[model samples]
Target: MRRVKLSDQIAEDLRRWIVRENLGPKDRLPNERALQDHYGCSRGTMREALKALEVEGLLIMHSGPNGGPEVQQTSAEIASRQLRQFLHFQKLDFKHVYELRRSMEVALALNVVDRLTAEHLTALEDNIRLCENANNEQERELARQAEVEFHDILAEASDNPILVFICQFLNGLIRDLVDYRAGSLQEHEAFGARNVAYHKEILAAFKARDRDAVAKAMDEHMCCAETSMQQLDAAFYSDLLSRR
Candidate 1:
């Protein structure tokens, strides 16, 4: 096994301390001297560890009086950025993204059906309307954003942190890719209409709280999107492959 850095180990120990103590955001951590003494490490090592956690958005270090590293809420934006960086290195094509979404999104919809709140359902309906009302190319692009927003809401409503992060990251990646090939997306007029219809069906399923129907609706929506995009823009897959 690869050797772990001392600072990394120290950082993890501090994280455990936070959890064990049920630390909340803005809760002041122990002073540098105390942390160094408790961990039996030098000030430099302790500081390095604190710095590591700070970079992860788990703590904020302050210098003056009433200052030390304070616990901070972990933000999804931080996690999303890291995941995006990893996907960039992986050089995933659009097909890879769609395939992954096809495999998992149905499960997400099914899981979230029972969990959908009044607010979540309302937001989803509004996004569907936004997509339906998109008239010009510019409006269509905004509609596409609203469509992604709908998926983002679904992911958040799932209330499973892992699912939430994966879905949001994938949705973000797809949006970026679509924006990269905006011309191709614009060429697919039928796609926008079909997408709105599919979302309407999915929304209806969600409103009914029917898990099986929701999963089926989601599966069909993904299949239609993949087929329509591939057929309308013959170079779509090739463009994505070249990016890889």
Candidate 2:
């Protein structure tokens, strides 16, 4: 095995210490000077290690008298934001994203259909009501969030933590790329109406506990979204980019 750098080794050691000590959120870490001396590394090496942990959302570097690096638990929102940035940098196409979503969501639908409880059904209905009541752009944005929450509830009802995590991450990415607020009110209503209808279909399948129907509904829903995104891109290209 290739020898790891001293700085990385130091970072790993600190990570283990945090876990072993069961450090809660915002627990202050040792000062830089102490870490440098304890690890037998230069100040720069210690700083590099700390910075690595900070980037991973495991530590927050604070300044002033009341400040130091503090341990932090990672949130799904943070992870999704970081992943969205990375995907944006890569310039991922809509088709690639759609294919990935279809595969994951279809599987998730099949897995969750039989497992949904009455409580989950009520949560989904609440989201649908919110979407129906959405009037302005701000309310529409809230409705979009509710839509994501509705799907998240289904993913959670599947009793698979990994699937729930992946679905939430993708849902955030799609929301960011779509620019829902940039469109007109009519466009928002059109999109919301279609989404509500498709969700109802999926919910019906879930209610009946039909795995194949759930899979079909999810696949169709993703295809509709993919087509809508393509149309939006075409309109954008024609109206905005072509005018330039």
Give the clashing residue pairs of candidate 1, or none.
none
List where candidate 2 sits over 4 angstroms from the true fold.
1-9, 12-34, 60-71, 135-145, 184-187
What TM-score does structure 1 among the candidates reach?
0.83
Clashing pairs in 2: none
Model 2 — which ten-residue stretch has the worst lDDT? Answer: 177-186
| Residue-level lDDT tens digits of model 2 in 96-210 | 6777888889988888877778898999888777777873566766766666677777777877778888887888776776663235224666777788888899988888888
In each prediction, how many residue pairs overlap at the backbone (N, C-alpha, C within less than 3 A)? 0, 0
Ten contiguous residues minimizing lDDT sum, candidate 1: 228-237
